[model samples]
Target: MELNYEGFYRFVRDELNVDLNAYKEKQLKRRIATVMKSSGALTLEDYSELIASDEVIRNKFLDYITINVTEFYRNKDIFTDFEFILRDYLNRQFKNIKIWSAACSIGAEPYSLAMILDKNNIKTNEKIIATDIDDNILKKAKDGVFKDFEIKNLDKKDLDKYFIEKENKYYIKDNIKGMVSFKKHDLVLDKYQKGFHAIICRNVIIYLKSETKDEIYKKFNESLVKGGILFTGATEAIYNPKEFGFKKISTFIYEKI
Candidate 1:
């Protein structure tokens, strides 16, 4: 049989439970092609067979597709804005806040939020739920050790307060680490947990198709309480926030209405 992209997509869904249809087709295809080239498979069928039998190849494919590029306080200006919003908007309404860091690669975003909460003195009994699709990334997040480059945006005071530096690596302090709970979650397939005071799903939905992004936004709106916040990536702003029952609160911040 000829190399079939559709068949390959189905095979991946069956084997990995990841729906490629949600991802932008052109970008997904380009990534798949790169994997195929690296694996020396000229045909999609050959690559699919290789992935089916080889654990290493399968994991590589999963990792590549997930796009795990993250850093502590990524897009520093936006996070600065978020800290203010958290203190002024969220803290005032919710006494014990529940936050979800969806597609939270390596835990930087949630940990950053935890630090902000700590700094602002927002006493919350509930821990932040930090989740990602990749199991390996979740493990790394649990470890909470980061290189200097990963935390470049953090100030010296915040660094000294929340991290212990040994050699060149920075380990998150027990207090900060304890405030976050990491888990493996696929945003496309998994049902969203509700009643969140805020949800930070940044730099992720840009890779998905418009319809899929819309569906996820709607789900996020449903997942949050009325007047809850949805903090998106700097580049992933919702053009029509009202469509998803959200009103634009700031540059990348949306409030559930």
Candidate 2:
């Protein structure tokens, strides 16, 4: 039997509440096919049936589809630029700040922001809201435990300052962990929260379709307050900042005008 891509997409939408259309079809279909093959399903229909009946299979399917490759301070240079921008913005603006780490996988990005804040001595009452579509990843983020490789970007000083090494794993200190709150959020389907001083949504949008990416950018703009910054991944720079009511301040950083 032939694999019905449309049928599988519909099944995922109705069953999982994830819109496959938001992703580029070629890449998304290839990923879905790979998952189906790995699961030993002969066709999309078979795979769909298997996922529908098996909770574990469904969860795996969801995990496979969402791109979750992230690390603390993934791109060091961009983060350095972000620190300077954030400090300058904070000094010029309000003392208290609210930041949203959209599509934050495993809490690294938000926790990184928290560490930067702590290092700079920025006192804020609000906890950083870090959100992802995966609940399991969110749970891991809340746990604040990471492997040695995940902390590779940090220098010795930072490592000692922010993490407690126990056996083979590194645990983020309470001060950093206390700065963030993790929540499960679907960027494609859910409503975005508003009035954030900054929104760091990096790398995640590259997997999305152009239209969906534009919609998300517009929503990010709406979510930010005036003069608020939108920090994206190095490769995911906005071609037209004015279209989204954003002014390009630096590479991968935009301020809402």
lDDT of 1 by residue, 101-220 (tens): 999998888999999999889977789999999888898899999998899999999999999999999999999999999888888999999999899999999999999999999999
Give the local distance difference test score of model 1: 0.92
Task: Show pairs that collide, candidate 2.
Answer: none
Clashes of each: 0, 0
In the order shown, the candidates' Cα RMSDs to the true structure are 1.1, 1.3
User: How close to the true structure is residue 199 of candidate 2, measured as C-alpha lDDT?
Assistant: 93
Candidate 2, 82-173: lDDT as tens digits: 99988877546977889999999988899999999999888777899999998778888999999988888999999999999999899999
Least lDDT summed over 10 consecutive residues: which range in candidate 1?
1-10
What C-alpha lDDT does candidate 2 achieve relative to the native structure?
Answer: 0.90
